[model samples]
Every structure is written in structure tokens, then in C-alpha cells.
Target: MDTFKKVTAIRGMNDVLPQASGRWERLEQHVRDWLRSYGYANLRTPVLEHTRLFTRGIGEVTDIVEKEMYTFTDALNGESLTLRPEFTAGTVRAAIEHNLLYDAPRRVYALGPVFRHERPQRGRYRQFHQVSVEALGFAGPDVDAEQILMLARLWKILGLKDIRLELNSLGAGEERAAHRAALIAYLEQHKDILDEDGLRRMYANPLRVLDTKNPALQEMAAGAPRLLDFLGEASRAHLDGVRARLDDAGIAYTINPRLVRGLDYYNLTVFEWVTDRLGAQGTVCGGGRYDGLIELVGGKPAPAVGFAIGMERLLDLWEQSKDEVVGQAVDVYVLHQGDAAARRALQLGEQLRDAGLDVIVHAGAASFKSQMKRADASRAAYAVILGDDELARGVASVKCLGDGSQQAVGFDALAGTLVDALSADGDAGMPEPSAAPPV
Candidate 1:
């Protein structure tokens, strides 16, 4: 028999370190709070779905399905299943399976990891995090405008100020059919100049050929048919209304005729948020209307609009602004000299916590100098010292670590003194311990 070696995580997977998770949690809290204020409820679907879901929902021509999908045969029943490449497909599957389409439009949001098999780069990964919103059974351009504006609000909540929005129109089914013909004809004229990927896109999805970022292909495709020219009267009016609403809300945007999202289901108005701070894959959020996807997935013909923000990409942007990401500050670290002192320290820790202060108790016994080093490393502003000498007098030394100033306080006054010392004014950069840190 051959011996087998233990295996670790496969390539393209990564463990989030403490500093990164702190930033992620801050971003998540901001997103959740904003979603709550906008009446978007949380929804969670399974990580794995029937393989056919992506095949039909994301479109088989897309790279996510043809190459990047992690599909397998289940051992239990031999059914084909795959880890989700995106959230929208699984959300739609759950909505149809659970009968969430009966009464009114469903406004739901989700945040979790999505899997894909691809070469990982600076901001791209095989296992990545995503935050998405799905608005089902809504058809008007007003709903489309609301979804776009909601996403902008989320970016504001993250304290991301330098961002740009790109908007486009894919028109309805019949209108798209006509546009597809004109687009293909243009690509055929430039067939010899096309690269391999561009050639594949031309046949697989002529619309995606317009979205290609290849400098040569982009130059060639510049004279191709623009979707804006082919938009039917309804789609034209709808897109105009969307832009008008955005302008009314003081949202800035650029109208790009070539902004067709990769997914096949999206139709009518489509938009993306980009930041020049991120190179290459600059789009942090992308979404559009999919009026016929519900019926394609076995639900009724329900119109919907949604978007997914690449959390990993957003965090990358946050890393560039870490100095602004407010980290947790330790209110106090109790330094005890002995067992009895440690007990008294624990008592004081509990008291401070009850009075709404963040307190981390010292573990085990160590020299006073060593304990001071630990307290300084914690970024804790205050250190409570209870030694044998101080315990004998029924008092503790309260030292402000920021300035090394020491004052003696009675045991009964420890909690109140600490709370008053760390109280945050509205303008203070320090965040309340109970609230999540900023990103």
C-alpha cells in the first residue's frame, strides 16, 4: 500500500489574517446597517446548488461556467452539484423553491463566500467574498434606479469617496436580438485582427466582445454597433428615466454604451461602479435587470434587478486606507502582582465591563515591567495596577498609558473613573467599543 501525505488548502485559497478580518468586519457592519435602513432584509442560500442552475442561469458560454466552475458528482446519490460561482443564481433558485414570488417584490441581500476555479491575481481569487442584493418581481425603471442608488449609499457607508459609476442599456429580448445581429456583423469584418479570446467571445457571446478590455480588440471594436443605437423605444425611455432619477438624487455617473455585464440573463438597464485606484479589474460592483431569468429557472416571468460587490476588491481598497480604519482600543488592561491581586483584578474587570467599558484581564503572573510591555502592545490607553502594597491599602494605581500618568483610586471608584476617562465626544476619532470599527 502507498502512504499518503497530508494535504493543506489548494492554490488560490487564502486565510484572512487578523488585521484583514478587522477591516472586513467593519465593512460588513456598515453594509448591514445601511441595508436595514433601506428595508432590504437578509437572506442566505446554500453554498452548493444543482449544476444545472449555473448552466442555465449564468449562461454556459461564460467563463464561470465553461472553465471556472467547481462541479462534481455527489457520492451519496451521484447527482451533479457545484459550488456557487455567484449569488444571484442560488438566490433565485431558493426563491422559486421556497415560493417567495407570490404576493409582492422581494428585496433581499446576502453576504458570503463564492467559489470559482481560476488563476488568482492581486484582487481576484478562487474563493472570494461577495455582497449582493436581489430585487424580484419589480419591473419599473424606478426600481432599477433605486437599486443603483442603494449601491451608491453602501459605498458611502464604507467611506469610499473616490468612485465612478458607468451606466448602459441592453434593451429587451427582441431589441437585443436585433442588436446581436448588427454586433456580430461588425466583429466578422475584423475577424483576422481578433485574438483567440476575442474570437471565442465573438461566437460565444457577441455582446461580451464589446466588454473585452484588450487594447487591440477595444480599438477595433470601437466602430462596432453600439447598444444605445439599438435600444427600443421602451428600453430607451427606461434608461433615460434611470439616468434622470440618478441625477435628481445628485448621483454622478458616466453613460457608457459598451458596459454589457458578463452574465447572459441581464437585459435592459445595466451599470457598474469603478475606481481608478484599482488596476485592471477596476469594477467593484456590477449588476443589471434580468426580466426573463425567473421563468428560465422555473419560476414565473418576474422582472428583477440586482448587483454584487466584490468584497475582496472593496477590502483591497480599504487596505489602502487602513490609517482611517479605526481599530479597537483597549479601555484598560489589569496588571496583577499575585494570585490575590489577580482575583481583585478580575473583579474590577467585570465591574468595568458592566459599566460599558472594554476590559482585558491579565492572564498568569508576570513581572510588572513585562506586564507594562503587554499593556502598551495592546494599544490600551489605561493600565490598572493592583500590587501587594496597593491591595493592603484597599486601593489600585490607575495609570494612563498614553502619558504614563498615575493616580490612586479606591476599588469602588475604579469602574466610574475608567468610564469617565474613556468617554467619547461626538467629534472624537475613537469609536465606541460596542460599535464596529470603521473601514
Candidate 2:
């Protein structure tokens, strides 16, 4: 019998090692903290969905459906299934399937992997993570403004710098239809000037011509009529209101007319957060209003708006900037010595826990030297050591790892000592906790 070839993770897929888990946890924690403060509850959806959901929802003309979707037929039923290319489509699908629209105007968020079979590059992967926030069943420009503002708050929380928000109004149906007609006529005139993709995009999605990377086409696109000029009074007012609110909130932005987002469902208030620091594909976050999304996904028409930030891209930025993430709660690391000392250390750990401190104790398995090494790697400020001698004397060694200062105290006072050491500087070197070990 022929042996099957040894399997490996598909190209563009990579394992995140234990050393990098801390960074991922930091990234998610940063996002979740802001989301909680803003009152958005978490919502999770499966990784696979009916393939046609994306085709109808993501727009067949867009590159995602045109080329990049990871589609396959379900083995059991032969239904065409796909690994989601992006979040909004599946999010809307889930909302509709669950009858979430009845709860009209729910603020929901999700963080998970989205798969797209595209040529991968630095910061771009076949399987990537996204944090998306959706506000469903609200139809006002205020909803749009809130969405953008919340995204701004999230960026601030991430401590990302030099990130610029690019805002655009895709306008309501009639107004966008008018803009598309004008854009089509313009693109048709310069049809010969476009490359194959641009030319195809012209007929399929002429507005996308404005997003072309082709230098010549881009030059011609510069002089085309701006979509904002064709906006109906309502869209224009909505756009103005969003801008005004952003200004009042002290968030900076630029209005770019060409930013008709790549999805078909988006309508009005499209935006992207970009930075020059990330090469080429610099859009770290993008989202917009999708009023018809619920209806398109087979539910009642619910006006929804949201944004999704690429976690990989976000982590890239945070690593580069060395931004501070809040909620570093690991306050103490307890090091146990011999057999009985491990039991005493565990008791002390519980005492510290009862004092409302975050405590971690070394598993009794590791050697004392190994435990110290783990403590150092954990970046714990206070390493409480309980050896055989200290245990017999009814005392413990609380060593401040930073200054190498050791204090021997009664075992009963161990919790207070740890708390005092932690409370001294508050934020000084509150090292992030390590990721949970693999099972």
C-alpha cells in the first residue's frame, strides 16, 4: 500500500509558538478591554458557512469571491461550504440565523480567524485573526459616527501611533447608483488606459477603478468626479455629522472620495485606518455601514455598522511601538523548595490570592533552579521562596527580583509582604503574564 505524504500546515499557515502567545494575549486583552468599556458583548461564529453566503454578501465582483475564497463542497451533504474570507459576511449570516435581529440594535463583537486563499506576504496570511464590532438595527448617522469613534478609541487603547483614519461616504442607494453611473462613464472613456484587472473591474465594479494600483489608471482616476459631490442631501448631512462628531471627540481623519470599500454590502460611512509603517498593504482596520446586510443574508432589513482590525497587523504595530497594554495582573510568583516546602508555598499562594492579589505557584515538579529560571522568564517582580530551612523556621524568603533585595519574614506575613511589594510602584514593570502552557 502507498503511504500518504507527511502532512504539514498548508502554505501561508504558521503555528504561533509559546514565546509568541504572550504577545497574542496582549493584543486580545487590549482589544477586549476597550470593547468592554464601550459595552460591546462578545459574539462568536463558526469558521465555515455556505459558500453562496459570501458570493451574495461579499459581492461577486470583489477579489475575495472572484479569486481568493477557500471554497469546498461538504463531504456529507455536498453543499458548497467555505472558510470565511472575512468577518462581516459571516457575522451577518449568524445574526440572521439566530434571529438576533429581533433584539434590534445589539452591539456585538467577535475575535477569531478568517481564511482567504491569497498570496501571503509579511503580515498577510491564509489564516489571520480579526476583531470585529457590529452595531445592528440602527439606521441613523449617529450609529455611523459611534462606530468610527469606538474604532478610534480601540486604536488609542492599542497605543498605536501615526495611524490615520480615512473616511468616506458611499452614500445611500440612489446617490450611490448615480455615482456608479458617472464613474462608469468616466472609466469607459479611459477604457484603453486600464490593465486587465482594472478593465475587468471597470465593468464589474468601476468604482474600484479608483482603488487601482496601476499608475496610469490612478493618474486618470485623480480627475474623476468625486463620490461626495454626487451625495444626496441625506448622505451629505450624514457625512458631515460623522465628521463633526469625530472632531468633537478630538479624533483626526481625512476624507478620501475613492474609498468605496471592497465589499458590495457596504453603504455609506466607509473608512480605513492606515499607517505608513506597515508596508504595501497598510490598512490595519476597515469597516462601514451595511444597512442591507441582514436582508441580504435573509433577515429583515437591519441597518448595521461595524469595523474589523487585523490582529496580526495590530500586533505588528504594537511590537514595533512597544505600546503598553493595561491589565498586567500577575502580581506574584511563588517558588517552592523541597517536598514539604511546596505544600507551604501553595498555602502562601492561597493567602496571597485571598488578599486579592494575582498569584502563581511553581508546580511541585520542577527543580528549584528551574523554578527560579521560570520566575525570571515570567518577569515577576516578587519571587517568594520557601526552602526546607525557611519552612522549618516558620519563615519564608520574599525576594524583590528587581533589586535583588531579600527579606526573611514569618510565613503568616507572606501575603502582606507580597501585596506591599506589588502596590509600591503600581505600574512599574508590571510584566505581562506568560501564555497558558499547552495541554
Candidate 3:
């Protein structure tokens, strides 16, 4: 006999259990619906792309490119391929390859898993999911404000609190270079305090040193040259325009000069929606204008602004505060006892499903009491009892799970009856069954 060995999922990577996947599904649907309402079309891109895409798009000196990407070479071609660390680069690559911006701007959204070789924590994971929203070809501050306001709507929809917005303007390339030179000059004098990592990147990408988590460098990093002061006339005006619109909409924000995004392509407006609930991974969503990304990724020069929310972070926050979303609950649970009833139950399931109802027919014959238990556990609004008597009469006893009321409905009436009961109970979120979640 062959010996077997135990295997486990890769560390930092995780499996979303069946019980917990409901919240993910609900949150995804909620965000998708909200994005669609704003005329954003769904965009799907490949998970693996040319390695240079991220290194060039996100930046060479960045942590993601330097230490976190899952990159490997193709055996036959010798070309480097990388599972995406973030979706923006892939999204932009797709836009360029597909010529999506040939005529006009496209408001697009994508949700998928991104791989990052990082230590797993409470809200951070090696393989994580993110929902990225991108607005391409729009150059005005109006679009920038719209993206921020859209996030506010998301928080409101998810019933999230304690999340606040922080904004900054990285200025244009010229202004950033000016600030970079000054920053390098100051850091040259403070060499003693520079950590090994900071010393290495002092000249290559000095701005990222400001983003360090090192307690020893926090005060010193804070006092580093502020990019906000280096904003040229155009950069300052662009930021002011965004702020004015935000002020008009009553969306409050703080301008943190040190809030340079971790990506290289970002320029002009940048923002992060942060919360205290998610431990050190406080940022739930972060994005800003990446006007140079399109050009860098071989597309015609175009302006773009968007953001991505970590699914893990969002799930954590939702569980802590807004755990009110209805999840994975069917509108009807069809219970059956014998072979004959099981056959009828399957037929009833199809009928209810065709009539636009969420039904989970009890599979594999079990005791009536056991089936009822399963029905209740399903959190279904109704438990459909298919006993011998009801089967012979071509009727099903539909018990309202929320209440104790029970009634007999004919096979033809079961779908409508369940629908009415679900409607009466205000369980409209469960309409037809959705596609299986990515558990």
C-alpha cells in the first residue's frame, strides 16, 4: 500500500469556508450593483501578465515589485510571467491591448484575487481579493471628486462607520522631481538615522521612505520635505478644484502631505479611505489619478483615477460593524422524506427555481425532523414539508420559518406562495439563486 502524507494550504493563502463565503458574495454583489448604477461596465483581465508590466507600472523600487510578486519563467518560452500583485496594471494593459479607449472614456470595475508574497495577518493575506474601479480618459478634477464620493456611497451602503478619507496631491512629474531633489539633499545630511532599507532607497525612490512603518523613522519621515509644498500652479489648481467640489458635496477629508501612494504611476490626486477597525492594515481603499500609467503601458496618453478595497479588510470591518447584510439564505427550503417525495422535491426545486426563487431541495433522504432542522439551518424564509400525505395530494406544507404559520400549497402554487411569503417577510435579497461563490 502506498503511504499518504498530510497536505495543507500554503501559508498566508486561505480558503473561505462555505459558512463565511456568504458575506463575500453579498458584499461583491452590493459593490457591483453600486458600480453599475454609476454607468461603470464590468472589466475582466487575466491574472497573469508579463513581469515587466508591474515593475514598470507599479515601479521597480516598490515593495510589491521588489519583495512580494510571485514571478516565474515559462519553461518553453523563457519569458517571465507573474501573477498580478495588483489589478490596475493588468486593467491598464487590457485596456491598451483591447483598444478599449478608442472612442471615449470607460468607467470600468474588476474584482478578483491578487497574489502578494507577504506575511498573513488579521486583515492581510498572501492571496487576497480586491474590487478595483477605474475611470479612464477623464482629465478633470470632477472625475476625481466623483471617485471619492462613490466610495462614500459604498460606506453608506455597507453601513460602515469610523472610516474617514485622507487626500493628497502628488503634483506633476516636474514638481515631484523638484521635491525629490530637495528630499534627497535633506536625507543626505541625516544618513545616521537612515535604516539599511531607507539608506538603500534614499536616492532611487526617496518618497517611499516616508511611507515606512519603522517607529524610529516616523518623526523624521514626517519632517521630510512635503510634496504638497512643491505643487506647481497647475497641480495646486487641480487639487483646489477637487477640494472645492468635495466641499460642495459635504464630503470631509484631510490633506496628508506624506500620503504618497505606494504605486509609482500615481500622480496629482491621491487618497485613502482608512479605518481604525482593521488593525495596522487600516487602509480599506486607496487610489488616485495615474495619468502616466496608460502611456507607460503602451497606450495613448490618457488620464485615469480609481481605487481598490481589500476584500479581507472589508469583510473584517463588515463583521465588526455592518454585519446586517442578508447572506446565503434561500427563500425556500424544499424538505422531502421518501424516494417518491425526493423525486417530487427535485421537480419542485426546478419549478421554484424557474419561477425565480431561491430553493435548496433537501438531498439524500432523511427524517422529516432532520430535514426540518436542515431547513432552519439554511436560514430559508420557508420550510417546504413534503410528507407522504402531502405528496399523495400533490401539495406541500410550506411552513414560514420566521413565524410558526403553516399552510398547504399545491405543486403549482408553491413557487408563488413562497415568493409572497418571502416578500411579506421583507426577504427580497434572496430572489433567484446566484452563481457559486469563489470559495
Candidate 4:
């Protein structure tokens, strides 16, 4: 026999197996409902896009472009392509390509996997899902504040706690330019305190240096020039407007002058929802206004703001804070012995399904004891047992998995019986099966 090597999933890429997939499904449903409530429609873009999109849209100097992106040349066309490191760049590109803003400003959201070549750690993955929401073509601070308020509602919906919001402004091009000049000068003065990463990004992307996680540079970065100070009159008014709305909404937030997001496109109104529950990977979601990105991505200049929540991190926080349990796979499990009974069981399963109850018929040969064990393990509310005698009498023994009460339910009455039993249970603790009249 020839030996074969086992193939495994790539590092940092993970499978959402059945046991954990229930939680993912629940989280996704909550996200969909939340986005819908805010009038944000869904927009989907492909996982792969032209590499120039991110380079031009996200800024060539940002870490996503310089280091994390999974870039490759197409085998057939020889054109450079990349797996999207984030959704905003692709969202803007799609909007421009499709003339999404020709009519009016659009509020759109995307939920899907994003690829990045980063080391996997707690709550961070190479292939991770993001809930991205973008409000394109909207100006003024109201839309920005609206997005922030939307996030606050989501945290409440998810029952997540201990997560605080931090806000900052990057100002406009000239304002950031002034801040950049002053920041570079400050960094140059503290060159000895800067790490290799900080020194490399010092002049090319000086703002990122302040956002560094390096403890050695934290003190120096904190002391550097604040972007809020460099804000011009318009920028100041814009930040103040967002703050006013947030204050009115009673959403508490901090003005962290050093909260420059990792992306190069953000110019104003950057914020992050941070939590200590997930250790050093504390940021569960972050986004900011990227007013120049639409124009840079070959569209008419449109002001836009958006945010992306890391599903993994958010799910982690949700699990920590909520005591939710995954419900049973099926409402009823059907088991039968003998060929005629097996045939009847299949029909019964479909009939129960038609009546709007989830039903699974036991497959292949199995003893009653064996099938009952499987039914109990399935956590079904009731088990419909059909053997030769029960099938001959045109009735099934309905055993309540909860309290072991068994009743004879005729074939015509089985679906109605289970529905009533399930409705009475109401997804609270399962109650004992009520007595059924003689068939």
C-alpha cells in the first residue's frame, strides 16, 4: 500500500464545525436583523478584486496593503489580484462600478469572510468574518453619529458588556498634513525611543506609529502631537457635531486623541469599540470616515463613513456575556422497525414536516433501545416509535423525551399532537407530554 500524506486546513484558517456553527448562525441572524432595523441594505462583493483597488483605496502605505494582504497574480490573465483584507475598499469599488450613488446616498452593509495573512491568535484569524456597514455619499456629522448609535444598539441587542467606545478625528488632508509634519518632528526627537516598526513607518506613515502596540513606544506616542489639536474649524465643528449627537443619545464615549485607525483612508470621525474581555485583541469593531476613498477608487467624490465588526471577537464577547443554549436539532425523531413500518415512518416524517415541525426519521437497521438512545441524544421534544404492532394498528407511540410519558397517537393526529405539545413547551423547559385520547 502506498502511504499518503494527510492534508489539513491552512494555518490561521479554521472550519466552523457543527457544534460551534449554531452560535455563528445565531450571531449572523442578529446582525441581519440589526442592520435591517437601521435601513441598511445588504451589498455583497466578490472575495477577490484587482490589487490596485486596495493599493489606491486603502492607501499604499497602510499595514493592510504593505504587509497583511494576500496578493497573487492571476494564472490565466497575469493580472494582479488580491483577497480582500477588508470590505470598505471593495464596497466603494462596487458602488462606483455600479453607479450606486448616481441616484442618492446609500446605506449598505456586508457580512462575509475577509482574508489577511496574519498570525492567528485569540479572537483573531487569517480568514475572519466581518459585519461591514457603510453609509456612502452622506456628508455632515449626523450620518457619522447615526453609525455610532447603530453600533450601540447592536451591543445592547447582543447583550455585550464592558465594551467602551473611543473616538478621535484625523481632520482633513491639510490638517493631517500639518499634524504629520509636527508628528514626524516629534518622532525624530525621540528616535531612540522608537522601535524598528515605528522608525520604518515614521516618515512614510507617521500616524500609524502613534497607533502602535509596542509598549516601549506607548509613552512617546502618547506625548506626540495630537490630531485633534491640528483640526481646522470645519474639522472641529464636525467632531463637535458628532459629539453633540452622541451626547443627546446618551451614548458615552472617550476622546482618545491617539485613536488613529490602522487604515490610511480615514480622515475624520474614527472610533473603536474596545473590550478587555478578549485580552490584548481588545478591539471588537473599528471604522471611520474615508471621505476621499470613493474618488480615489475612481468614483465621483462622495463623503462616506462606515464600521466593521469582527464576528469572531464579537461572538467571543457574546458567548462570555450571554447564557444562550443551542436548541434541539429536530422537534421530533421518528423510529420504526420492519420494512412496512419503515415506509410508514418516512411518510410520517414528511407529514409532520408539512405541519411545520422539524422531523428526522431514523435511518437503517436499529433496535428500539438503540434508536431511543439516539432520539434522546438528539434532544428532540418527542420520539414517534413505530414497530410492527403500532404500524398494524395505524398508530404510533409518542414518547416524551423530557419525562418519559408515552401516548398512542394515530397517524392522522400525530402532527397536530406534536405541534400542540411544542407550542405548550414554548422553548422554555420541556413539559410532560399531555395524555392523548385512544386512537
Question: Candidate 1, residues 1-439: lDDT per residue as tens digits?
Answer: 9989998887888898765576778889888888888888999999999999999998988879989999999999999999999999899988899889888889999899999998998779999999988899899999999988888887766667678999998887787778888888889999998888779888779887777767877787778888788877888999999999999999999998888865556788898999888887788888899987898999988899999998889987776755677565568989999888999999989988999888889999799999999898877878999999888887778887766777777777777766767774322332223322122
TM-score of 4: 0.94
- Comparing 2 with 4 on TM-score, the higher-scoring candidate is 4
Error of 1 at 244 (Å): 0.8
Kindly report which residue pairs in candidate 3 clash with one another.
none
Arrange candidates by lDDT, descending. Answer: 4, 3, 1, 2
Weakest lDDT window of 10 consecutive positions for candidate 1: 430-439
User: Which ranges of candidate 3 are over 4 A from the true structure?
Assistant: 262-264, 323-328, 426-439
State the weakest 10-residue window (summed lDDT) of model 4.
428-437
- Full-model lDDT for every candidate: 0.84, 0.81, 0.87, 0.88
| Number of backbone clashes in candidate 1 | 0
> Which digits, one per residue and each the tens of the lDDT, describe model 2 over residues 211-312?
888787777989888888888888888888888889888989988888877555678799888999989879988888888788887888878999888888
lDDT score, candidate 3, position 321: 77
Q: State residue 42's C-alpha deviation in candidate 3, in Å.
A: 1.0
lDDT of 4 by residue, 1-439 (tens): 9989999999999999977887898889999999999899999999999999888877887778888999999999899999999899899989999999999999999999999888899988899999999999998999999999989999999888899999999899898888889989999999988888888888998988988888888788879998888889999999999999999999999999988864555788999989889998999889889988888878889899999999999988988987765667689999999999999999999999999998889999999999999898887888999999897777898888877777787777788878888888655443333444344
Q: By TM-score, how accurate is candidate 3?
A: 0.94
TM-score of 2: 0.88
